[model samples]
Target: MKALSHLNKYLLKYKWYLIWGTTFTVISNLFGIIPAQLVRYSLDLVKETLDIYFLYNGSRLQSNLYDVFAFSILFYGLLILAMALLKGFFLFLVRQTLIVMSRHIEYDLKNEIYLHYQTLPLSFFRQHNTGDLMARISEDVSKVRMYVGPSIMYGLNLITLFVLVISYMVSINARLSLYVLLPLPVLSVAIYVVNTIIIKRSEEIQRSLSRLSTFVQEAFSGIRVLKAFVREENSATNFTVESDVYKQKSLQLTRVDSLFFPLIMLLVGFSNVLVVYVGGQEILTGRLTPGNIMEFILYVNMLTWPVMALGWTTSQTQRAAASQQRINEFLAVKTDLVSEKSLEREIAGEVEFRNVRFVYPDSGIVALKNFNLNVKAGETVAILGTTGSGKSSLANLLTRMYDPTDGVILIDGIPLKEYSLTSIRRQMGYVPQEVFLFSETISNNVKFGMPEMPQEKVEQAVKDADLYQNIIEFPEKFDTRIGERGVTLSGGQKQRLSIARAIARDPKILILDDCLSAVDTNTENIILNNLHRIMENRTSVVISHRVSSAKLADKILVLDEGEVVEHGTHEELLAANGVYRELYEKQLQAEEV
Candidate 1:
């Protein structure tokens, strides 16, 4: 019912179309009743053994004598043709208008869902499958569109059939018509009971279908990894299981669907047999006439659709319910942190951490505790740490990806929470440990941060990142498509592309999270030298395990076991003969050996 209600809101917007649609439905029924009445009158005329006086539709045309058989055939034929013309004319317009409205609903819903997904915080994506999210936006929204179109049309058609049939039945012989409708309650109950099962099964089928779609999407996206690992058989087997599950669920639901038509036929068939047996005796005993029997039979035909539509409407209702549930689930999700706070002034890059403590949700392991640091604007800082040393978490706090649990991270002496998320991130040009480029042209990827960039700006940024020469070397130059995740490009080139993309924005502060590890030492040095020129009077934070990169910064912080164990200039850290010295000596020894 909830699914039906949501669909109704949109359908009601075009009420006049449905109004005319239902009115035309009744018009079809009116024409449909004419053939049975004509047959009975023609039979009565023949039985009386009198010359059949035909008005020829009141035109007084001679259609009589030896041509009576031909006249009867032509009369019914032309009536059927006229009925068909009326039915098709109205049904066509109704179908066209409904489809247009359904398309509008589909377009609006798909765009809105996609936009909502974009605005949702990062954690929402982290806990959900990418393919599942896609299914909710694509497949489920389409289900709603299908429901909105045909289900409403059919459901209303059923009501019109009921009203038209009952009116005709009561007008002919109220007492006899009442007896014919005796089987209706039984038929209704049967439809109701069977429809419940159909609805339940339909939901199961839809869910299994989404799971299969997700599996296929994931398989395609990660095909390269599977092939590289020689896991083709494993992937195929997994996909087959998902597909088979989908098939079984669809078959099960359709099995229920198959039962519906047969049940309606049986019940309606039983009613027909009863009406004919009883109505025949009534006519023979002078209690009724052949005309009444013929009319009842026509009414029975009218009843067929309502029974058939019960099955279709049941299926559509169930799909809509499932789609609504999925959409509701997405709308309910809320992110733990991040906001858009408006401030009167712009933020300078000076960053401070005061008594910062952090822990991940599932893994309650403390990644940082009582972390404190203060760096002034225009000063370059480097962080050296082993794996899982909370260096990345610290950077995440500065970018406001995750907030500290027990303390404050500040920018320019203002709490991070006080600054708008956009304002905070706009100041920092961050390059993650793993570089990713879109499956788009190199120029488009480089200019991604500032898409409306001038050609000169894009070219200059590429040059500053030391990637312009490499891009021009390609046959298609910067317009060449980078394969998925920049797979077609070398690791060094990918990192430089990431650098170019980040540099294109011309941010006030830049954070490089060991993002240039793939480049040679000489190349890394040159990139760093260029970065220094760009970062002049601008803050920059370098994070790397490589000592060569650390030497470029004016100050360094060495972290161990979620704690900052050392902080100083390169010479000061070497003089302390602690963690930084040990790390420096290890690199030197590795080169010498």
Candidate 2:
């Protein structure tokens, strides 16, 4: 009952639909039951007129038995035709309403879930794979719809059938009706046991299925990499392993599923047998009429559905409960990054980091420590470091992707937390070391696939990135579609396009994390020179591996092992005999060799 009570909450929005649907079902079934009753009643009326034929000592029929039989046949045919028409109309009506309700509920819930994902921190995505989350939105949500719309309608029909059958049975013989209901308790117990197993197994099956899908997606996306590495056998083996787990789990679920209805039928079979046997004896003893016995059998036949439906509903109820619990668990994890609770406002380009220390949510130690820096309203600061020295992590802090564990970041001398995330984010443009591009047209990629953007603005951004000339050489130019992750583009092209997309917004503070790494030094110089022209009077952070790249910056900071070891002008840092001097001298020596 509590499970049903929980399910009703989702159904509350569709109360009017259920009310009209159930009413139609009841009316249709009333006409349906009439024909069965006519057969028994017509036979009883014939007993009044037939010849002496009771070898078992039954009463003879009265006069005009053939006319009575003919009238009953006509009424039965008319009742069936009327029932068919009513049932068909009800089918059309309920289907239309349920389809609308299902679509509305699906859309509303999907939007809410998507918005929830937006509010969660980046750590959430790191902990869960992209494919599994996609499956939940697509496949799992569809299952929820199944539970909501049609499941409810069929459930109502089953209940209506049960109620009508019981009322008619009471009219036949009260004591015998009680006897026919004897196995109902057993039916309940069986359903409870089977439902528990199905629920537990279904959850396992769903988890395994998600994992299998994730593995396939990962493999497909990295197929070129796997082929280049000659890891096809390994990839296939890994997929096979995942697929096997899903297969076994699904079979275990099916094993449980196949037993649900038949086993319930087996338990309820005795009642069906007992009704005919006991009701027939009552008739022979002159305690019940033939029509009464026939009516009782119809009622017995009707109990089968609710019993079977109870079993199926039991499984569906548990699935919905499990799904809700999983969704609740996801929503319960508090986000580490918190935005401003107040109004959003514009931000000035000035940024300051005071003794900032950052620790990744997954790591035990700080990735950036004791960092102190300031960028004026319009300045270019370049960061120099070896791999794993927290270059990209520094840029991430500016956007508040992860807040510092110990220190404060300020915008226009106000604590960054004071400004809403949208306001703060709108002022900064970032191009990561690992460039990510969507599958879309070249123009859409430049626009980051924004549904609406000025065409001239996109063209300007592409020109600024120095990719406009190359794009025009492609077969379709601006209309040329990019593949997933920009697979169709070269590494340098991808990085340039990502840079173009970020720059398209005309941001106040721009950060490039070795985004020019893929291009040749000559090409890199051209793009950087172009960026300088466009980013005039704008605050910028640039990270580059080549020592020559730092020469264009107003100031340079050298980092090693997450600590800022040296900071000053490019000339001053080389004279300081610190991390910057060492890195510069090493690159110089490599070029000489």
Candidate 3:
């Protein structure tokens, strides 16, 4: 119930819808009550006319009275029909206003969750799975919609009908009305017990569903790997286990949920029996007429549906509360990375790391320690390092994907935090070691960083990355749809496509993090040769394991165990005969073999 309080703002936002829907509900119930009264009046009128006809048997006046009674009964039937039609029309209005409001709220809520997801840090994503995140936005939101729309609408209908129908029953005869309502207290107790059980079971069911969704999502995403490992049988068995858990949880909930209607009907049946038995006693005592008994019966039947719907409304509300609690959990998370200032001027691409130190928050592993470097605007610097030598960590810090645990990073003499995150990222192009591309056209993937890039620039970017020939050979050229994660392209082509995407952005600072690892030596040389021209006036950082990639840089760095072991120009480093020289000689031997 407390979790559901979060929806109050949405309720207030669409207050007019609620107001109109309530008005319609009241009018519909009013119209519905009129038909029962008409039935009672028609019954009593028929009885009185029959008595008069018996008194004037065989008289011409009796025939005149018969025609009058026939006309009156027809008029009553027409009036009842009109009331029912009006009731139905207003009920339609109730759905239009209330249900439509719920849909609008659903749209707003999903957008709000998605927008919040975009602001969350990469670490947050690491802590959660894709399927759980998707479930919250889709499945959880749908359950909430049930509470706001159908449950609320039916609950209102229940209240309105009960008030009108019960009031009329009591006014006609209080004692009989009391007996008719005797079973309602028992119904109330049953609902309370069932509602408590429903809340617990509903939460369990939702969790099971989330686990099932995650299993299916992972299985499909990693299907290629599963096939490669020949683990199809094991995967299917795991899927069956997850499915069985979900099935059991659902059945448990359904078993409890199944009790709702039967209990409601049983209590209602008791109320009907009481009405007939008690109303007969009243009639025998001459305190009630046959018309009165008939009208009471009509009123009881009127209350039946609403009373039955009460249990369903309660169950829906409980499920909604459970789902809202999950949604609120994510909504309450505050992102750790906060932007301090907005950049008003274009970046000059002079990057500096002043005694920077960093540790991965998730694993508590130190990736960098006392690292210091300064690159002037438009300079090319190549960082050479083995695996786990903090080479990628440097790239991560430059992109502001993670802040250093200690020390400061500056761009153009301004602290990195001083600039707006969006402004800094917009001016920087990064090609990561692990590349990811959308399942879109080749041209769209190339223009991913800048969607409005011109065709001429797109061609130039592909040419600069030395991927123009392969793309032109494709059937659709730039328009070819690369499958999921660029599966349709070869590894080298995918890497080159990533480079083309970065180049198309025309960024002031470009960082290529071992992006050419997959290309053959000849292709790597060709791409490097083109990059020498492309990187002329832009600040670039080349992170790689190859010495050939560093030969053209103005400066080179060799890193070992998160610390710089050697730094100098290529000729100077070769003359020094240190770690860089050793790596260069080893790579030269491998190429020769």
Best by TM-score: 3
Model 1 over residues 159-265: C-alpha lDDT tens digits?
Answer: 77788778877887776777778877876787678768876776777678778777888878878888899999998999888888888888887777787778778
lDDT by residue for model 2 (1-593), tens: 33324345456877776677777777656655665576567567556434333332433442344556567668766766776677678767767666567677777667766888888877688779877777677666676666676666667767777787777777767878888988888777877787888878877876887788788888888889989999999989988888888898878877887887788778667887787888888888888877777766766665667667777766776776556555555656777677666447666588899999988886565689899889898888898888888888888788777788899998788888877887778678889888988888988877663447798999889988889999999999999989888999999899989999989988889888898888876787788788888678888888877776787788898888889888899889888887788888897898577
- In order of lDDT, best first, we have 3, 1, 2
Between candidates 1 and 2, which one is better according to TM-score? 2
User: Top lDDT: which candidate number?
Assistant: 3
On residues 1-593, what C-alpha lDDT tens digit does candidate 3 reach at each position? 89999999999999999999999999999999999889989999999899998999999999999999999999999999999999999999999999998998888889989999988877788788888999999999999999999998999999988888888888999999999988889989999999999999999988988988898899888888999999999999999999999899889889988998888888888888888899999989998888888888888888888888898989999999999999999999877777777765698899999999999887788999999999999999999999999999999899888888999999999999888888899999999999999999999998886888899999999999999999999989999999998989999999999999998898999999999999999999999999998898899999999999997799998899899999989999999999998998999999999
The estimated TM-scores of all candidates read: 0.89, 0.92, 0.96
User: After superposing candidate 1, which stretches have Cα over 4 Å from the reference?
Assistant: 3-80, 285-292, 336-340, 591-593
Candidate 3 regions exceeding 4 Å error are: none
Better of 2 and 3 by lDDT: 3
Worst 10 residues of 1 by lDDT: 48-57
**Every candidate's CA RMSD:** 3.8, 3.4, 1.7
Candidate 2 — number of clashing residue pairs?
A: 5
